[model samples]
Target: MRVHLGSDHAGLDLKNHLVAWLSEHGYEPVDHGPFVYDALDDYPVFCLRAAEGVAKARAAGGDDLGVVIGGSGNGEQMAANKVEGIRCALVWSEDTAKLAREHNDAQMVSVGGRMHSLEDMTRFVELFLAEPFSGDERHVRRIGQLDHYDRTRELPPLPESAIGLGPDA
Candidate 1:
């Protein structure tokens, strides 16, 4: 798989480890910068570009994935999702990482620099890389709606099937 990685100064160390690990596991890891870290360097610049790389690769051929890391990972995911066609999911656990790929077709994952041990990170990455998106019709429809929103800047219309049908509705 073609995997892109992006990290801020806070995540530089872990990112380095992940790149090596990915190579050993046969993934092509593409670095998106913070190559030489500065403490004040922002996560958005690298994260956005990483998402772009994956998006570009997917457009060129098959799907490509991206990983973005920062102190908390929240801003990194936010930044990655700003790019159109990038479904970025912030995952703190192995389960969430797997689910992000399986259920959301998430092309990008965000990890926190300070949240987990190296072992945990490895587990999360392994599951994320292994899981495949379910691609059920509902999931496909939902992602399509999101993609439409991204392209048209339009609010989603309520589905007739969804109206007044929830537990509280």
Candidate 2:
């Protein structure tokens, strides 16, 4: 599989390390930016582009994914998710990393470099790559609803039990 990667200055080293690591682990790595660190660099540009690369690859029938990194990863994930068709998840733990893919079908993973040690980062990425989406009906349905909402700007209908007045009213 091909993986696209991007990061701000804070995550540049990690992104570089992962590029080599990913290639050694038998995946093609696409470095999206920060060829040379720019202290004033913005995260969204690279993150969005990386996510776009993955989305475009999928549209072309390629099995590509993306990883975005930053000091906190929160902004990067949010920006990546703004791109249509990109499901970017902020991953802090191995379980959450794997679950992002398994439950949300996330095509992009955002990691906070300041929050974890190198070993844990490696473990989290490995777990994320190893897991497969369960594709359970409810998960699929909910993701579909999110997609519908994204397109239609409509709120999900409330559950039946939540739609009525209280009995004591």
Candidate 2 lDDT by residue in tens digits, 1-169 = 9999989998898899899999999999999987788889999889888989999999999989889999989999998999998998999998899999899989889999898987788778878887888999999999999999999999787777776756522
Decoy 2 TM-score against native: 0.95
Model 1, 1-169: lDDT tens digits are 9889999998898889989999999999999988987999999889889999999999999668989998888999999999888999999987899999888999999999899988887788889999999999989888988999889989687678888877636
Instruction: Please give the range of 10 consecutive residues that has the lowest summed lDDT in model 2.
Output: 160-169
Candidate 2 residue pairs in clash (backbone atoms < 3 Å) = none
Instruction: Give the deviation of candidate 2 from the true structure as CA RMSD.
Output: 2.4
Task: Give the poorly placed runs of model 1, Cα more than 4 Å off.
Answer: 161-169
- lDDT of residue 35 for candidate 1: 91
Error of 1 at 75 (Å): 0.7
